[model samples]
Target: MRIAFVHRRGGDDEAVLGQAAALGRAGHDVHLVAADADDLRRTPGYATARRTVTVTTGHGGDPVAALRALRPDVVHVHHVSADPGRSWVADWTGPLVATLHDHHPPCASAGLHRDGRYGGSRGARLPLAWASRGGTADDPLLRRADRLIVLSETSRARYTRAGVAPERLALVPHFVPDGTRGAMRPEPVWVYAGRLAQEQGITELLRRWPAGQRLDVFGGGPRERECRAAAPDSVTFRGVVEHAGLVRRLGRYQGLVLPGRFDDGLPLVYSEALAAGLPVLAFDGSPTARTVRAEGTGTVASWDASLPAALRAASLVFPTLRAHCRARYEETYGETQWVTGTERLYAAVVRAGAREFA
Candidate 1:
């Protein structure tokens, strides 16, 4: 299949690149259409793609003319917000599929965190209310897709409640390449890799950090200084680490700490940790926590006094969970599964012909 992947140049660039690489590996002719030409040539996917095109414009250069020239069998959009005016989806009338990478349209903040809490004013529950408050743009672009790819059941439910048809929504979680390089024994320490922001529950993680427990935090953000000050001596702030470097070092840690308080679908870090045979310690009420509980790949605890005890218990069971974590990643979050599922969706959409919701 000739697949043309479109995305705006931003945060989800790595994920988009990964998907393009996976499809390319599967013997499909994959092309990339990026909104901005800047820094794309340096990315690994830039070289992996059969051909790459950039629409260096504010409103995403004439989508019809650019895409029609490619003559792709399937057009997969990694992020709809890439086009500020969203003219690309409006202009393209083909077998289009889009992945809702974050909580947009309904939750304007995109992370589902606002005002120090998760879920911004019942946006995920009451779409009409959210739309009334000048939040109307992105949802229609999602609904217009031939298939809407959601990362988790949490996301699927949120979009379903927000008026996307159940039939159109496809639950396809993100995948990361396996980074485990052998029988590397893990040290008795926990690792956290993400933005050190309040929304990520970094504040609570530092404030309620348990003594005697060792934690190494990677990545920088707004709360870095505050978190550094508040964190105990046992906690080490490793600053920013590139994704490839972090994944390479993941097998050295006993477990990954996901203290996010919001419903961020399923973070790619979760899959990365699992791929490295590392269990996860996620905070309660998150999609990652739910997966950890269901898969028994790690422990889920609330950010409170009991967190210390929870960590201790998780450590005790960590030895037994390592193999299970790796197995879970292979079964659910591996690239083969993602590519197979994506290919199936693309084939189905192509057969169904070009159809759009009213």
Candidate 2:
């Protein structure tokens, strides 16, 4: 099958390209449409076309003509620029579908989580982000997608409110390959991957962690210096680590500390951690945390006054946490989970001839 994946990126966007690359490796003809090449060179099977504008989510030609040129069996979009009104695919006809990786339509910061918290007033939610050039995702383009895929139930709820019909929302997870999972070997190094954004709450995690607890902070962000300063003497800053480095790094950590206050669907970062056999310590007051909270796979708290105690208890329950995290990964997000869920969605979209309601 010929699948064209589209996303406009000015950053390290392996998450978007990883899906197409994995699909290609799994026997599909995958093509990529994007705004940059620095990141693309590293992604296998990635092919690019020229762009007429910087943020238009459309190809240079007419929407129909552009898609027609690709002749794709499926069009899987991961993002649309803030002006989704300018996105060409909005008018195209091939199995229209996308994964709402973040709250881009309703939130300019895209996390619907800003000022380091989740869910706020419309003004706060819609800051700078517009699904259409002039309109928020409250109408039109959001409703246009045949099916809307979200990473977590928390994201599904937000999208549903953002005007994507609940019927159209599919909770399809991001892919995390077995090769990505690490060998959680020795020591109790708590891991924090992804950008060290305060929205990610890594600063709070370090500040609140008990003294003497060793932590490894990976990924760079605007708050890198602050995170470094707030870190306890036990913490180590490894700077920016790639996907493989992440897995190798996870092997040294007993668990991952992913206390994000943002509604970023399910971060493949956390998914990657679980696959690596590292338990998660997370706090998100939304259904999104269900994956990690289900029956002790890891500890999930509300990030309220009660959170610090929960974190302490979780550290003590390391043996149980270790056992369950691996179990949950095997049962729900292992090799089978990655391939089965994605191919199923692709096949269904192709057969139905439209991205059906999930």
| Per-residue C-alpha lDDT of model 2 across residues 86-195, encoded as one tens digit per residue | 34655676786777666445545554442233444678545345443343454444656667777667777776676666877888766665554334455766777777
User: Least accurate stretch of 10 residues (summed lDDT) in model 2?
Assistant: 48-57
Tens digit per residue, CA lDDT, model 1, 188-282: 88999988777788888888888789999998888888998999999998998677788989989988999888776777889999899999988
What are the clashing pairs of model 1? none
| TM-score of every prediction relative to native | 0.87, 0.78
Q: Which candidate leads in lDDT?
A: 1
How many clashes show up in model 2? 1
